[model samples]
Target chain A: MKISAKEVQNVAELARLELDEALTAKLADQIGSILNYVDTLKKVDTTGVPPTNHALSLSNAFREDVVVPSPGTDKALANAPLKENGCFVVPKIVG
Target chain B: MTLYNLSIHDAAERLRKKEISSRELTLSVLERIAKTDTKVKAYITLNEDQALAQADQADQAISKGIARPLTGIPLSIKDLICTQGLLTTCASKILENFVPTYDATVIEKLKAQGAVILGKVNMDEFAMGSTTEHSGFKITANPWNLDHTPGGSSGGSAASVAADMCLGSLGSDTGGSIRQPASHCSVVGLKPTYGRVSRYGLVAFASSLDQIGPLTKNVKDCALMMNAIAGYDPKDSTSVNECVPDFTATLTQSIKGKKIGIPREYFSTEGIDPDVKNSIDQALDTLKSLGAQCVDISLPHTPYAVAAYYVIAPSEASSNLARFDGVKYGIRDMEQTELVDMYKKSRSRGFGLEVQRRIIIGTYALSSGYYDAYYKKASQVRTLIIRDFKAAFESCDILISPVSPSPASIIGQHSEDPLKMYLSDIFTISANMAGIPGLSVPCGFNQMGLPVGLHLMGRHFDEATLLNVAHCFESATDFHTKRPSL
Candidate 1:
């Protein structure tokens, strides 16, 4: 299926990526080509096969709940570009 | 001995005999890196002071008679591994200055074993590309031929070891990140079965397919790394709890009657280079001479690997990488008038174009209108690919093939076409899809004098068997001894 310019913009918006007008057209062409190429999966018969979300056969490996003071709030926030009041600050979501 | 050339086994042995201090060895590798990395561009970050301090402590430990498999072995870590107080960028602009607060589980184990941390090696951004060209910082050139690309996203790890810039390095193999480079660079690289190593601090590219293993110069060193890093990790919910065998213990076993599989599917016409085919044939001949029962088998769904991988890996990556939004870690723009704008601006400014393309494509695939048609359908095909291996393995002890379809391509050959770039992982991704063990050992060099990696695959969590097969092959061949002409 051809990816419309509108769809490209939607995906770009959803992915939170900034795109110039040139890039938007290039992305449309590239993604359009990719989608066209990837359509080969449509030919395979996978009626009885169960989808594989996890590659390993095992399940339910969990760490016990225990308090560990590691990479505390300060350390976690250290990589953030902007912060305020011990929290990552961002632009207003609500008007 | 050059620190870059010494295997972990040899380094540890020499250190125990007091032949060389860890400080001396660490400095040697550091100096080697200093001299060559200007052209190779293998290392992204080097901790000279910290490395020397660790080496001194390891020397002290050895002086006091402390013993461990990795002690006093200075190894490079792939940039993907988290190093506390050091940048772990995944070689992407997105997390350019993001220093992880905690060490990856492998890092912790290496430190505990007294292994010297030489530095972090470069790779394709987020382990997404087969060639290191996808990296945002700079393309890592192959040690064998600077004009050719180093296969990646573990290209730096493989190239560094190949050039003797570092003795060994840890690399994640979601789809041949470790093995392909090892093939291109003529080194030994292993991808332990999925869940063989913990993923707690690894910036997850794909949860299911990702497994961290060492890229080393020889099989014995790969075994040493497998032993230390192959245990169950409670931190990662998917970490397998099966017992990790002392992988190095079976190094001397014979390979007389092991049923080695040669899948005709691999040799079939998907553009297998003649040199690779010759090397694989030579490899099979050597194994046959050593008493291996070779048989033909089929993994008919082999063509589906790239398609399924692109869908599943990117789908998972889209989810895993979502946490990198500027708000929590890395770069976040404050000047945005709205929160959504802040996120878009940060990610757009941070991630490279290829990474953005993937994130966009992944988000599109997993979106509400297309989830069932794309992500869900691709996943079902992934199951068929897994079953193909499962059936084939039942008829053979281990399967062997070429690590890559072609030898290392020249830099910028396929960097422009993402689909073409993704096909480079064709021969290796199926192993990851099946969550089985995969290894790449230098088989021979092409007419270009570049290397060709022979791939050995085994059943799930069967690194021991794979190592035994590799050891058997190495004992019979001198490919491991061949290094780039520096």
Candidate 2:
């Protein structure tokens, strides 16, 4: 249950976060203590208990597929940090 | 009473009677904000000119005899809910300048009711922290005492209502965000049933746990706001199709013969401030005197609620926040050449320390080998917690407890320790975990003159019962009427 600095680094990488050594060490220690506290759940026997992902139990909400007016390209890209030619501009994915 | 300090119902009556104009009311509120918001820091963005224009429209509607309950009311909105063409920062640097092209379903509903929006208020960045100190913009102080926190992440909403900057406000609660701040600031806050209000425009936190509700000066005003906002919406699949009742119609109903459950675990929980306990005990006596029966009940899984919430909320947040990568919306890093590098750099630079910590914790919990030990186990515990509430509700009409273990803490008291801050939400988290309606009403003041909130929780979609009980308490007490000296 003790999270090491290296594991913190690995998790940050997986989470796409760039944490410096100090934050990584601090997070490892903090997350380790929190997990240790959360380990109390292990004491509660949850045998045969179905995990609840949501509080309300509802079936799949399906609606008929139909063409709906979109917000339009201009409105959709209004909040885009970088955009060009009615499209979102992003860094090159393929060299 | 000053026009700015009038409750929604009172102001509505005045506006309808032609005793006060909406423009006058809005001007009074704007003047109040201009005077006090510097010290309280409740608002992040003030909509002065727009509010005046809306007030004029409201006055026109009033003159035409078509005014609604909120027709001329000026209210602040928590920054997370999208406001069309308005700055909707979730109090984060990532979306500092993000403006929504469309209103959130709740915002649209409020606008349709002629509610004049004052502006977007500050909150914890991403609604992640219990205190507004984590806001990327600024920290909102508790109106009662400038040195203390207005319990968050709805701190700004509660403080604005308590400080008379606005008549009422809309706040989203993922855990105890709404109720806790309402408690600390001695205002009224209600977190409706998970599906009771549409979440279409709310910036996703923990999607399953997040809900939009109202914070107001009194319980009836809270009910009025609920009547305006709660209902089904085709836009949000999670919004329930249940009938939205007249939330204010049941406010005057007597609590006689109502079965109030006193959770034994909550009373015995460690670290509950003595002053808070004393206030709750006195409040219970008042309820008992009003002909209500207090029953002893057990929610044995109460201790594990904070633990389960940490895992589940963070896990959901990590996944939901993935959309913030440098491309579609929010800030992007232009210095990085590679796509992945830009994502990493932008996210790291955009997010605050607490956000990064949660993302890491969530990623680690959901990681391959740790999934069973963390996320699954937490989900199973959530089931147990839900079962506890279901059984407790069967025996009692409502559950009453302290909103928070203590009153608002001094600012920076828990800033150094994240776990300590998380534990402050212990009492309030279970209501969110169970997805039931929870309310906070001003019960009494602590020894330091800080307000203490009486927590009332009810069955699923049973906000009426909670409102009735809170209204009854307000009728019998003057706590809600005691304004903080700014």
What's the DockQ for every one of the candidates? 0.76, 0.86
User: Total clashing residue pairs per candidate?
Assistant: 0, 0
lDDT (C-alpha) at residue A77 in model 1:
81
* Residue lDDT tens for model 2, B61-102: 999999999998999999999999899989989888888999
Q: Per-residue error at B154 for model 2, in Å?
A: 0.5
**Chain B alone vs. reference chain B, TM-score for every model:** 0.98, 0.99
Model 1 vs. true fold: TM: 0.98
In candidate 1, position B481 carries an lDDT of 91
lDDT digits (tens) for residues A1-95 of candidate 2 = 79899999998888899888898899899999989888988998999999998899977888889989989999999988888999998887786
TM-score of each: 0.98, 0.99
List of clashing residue pairs for candidate 1: none
The true-versus-predicted C-alpha distance at residue B297 of model 2, in Å, is 0.3
The parts of candidate 2 lying over 4 Å away from their true place are none
lDDT per residue (tens digit) for residues B94-164 in model 1? 78888888899999999999888888889999888888988879889999999998888899999999999
Candidate whose TM-score is highest: 2
Comparing to the true complex, what docking class would candidate 1 get?
A: medium
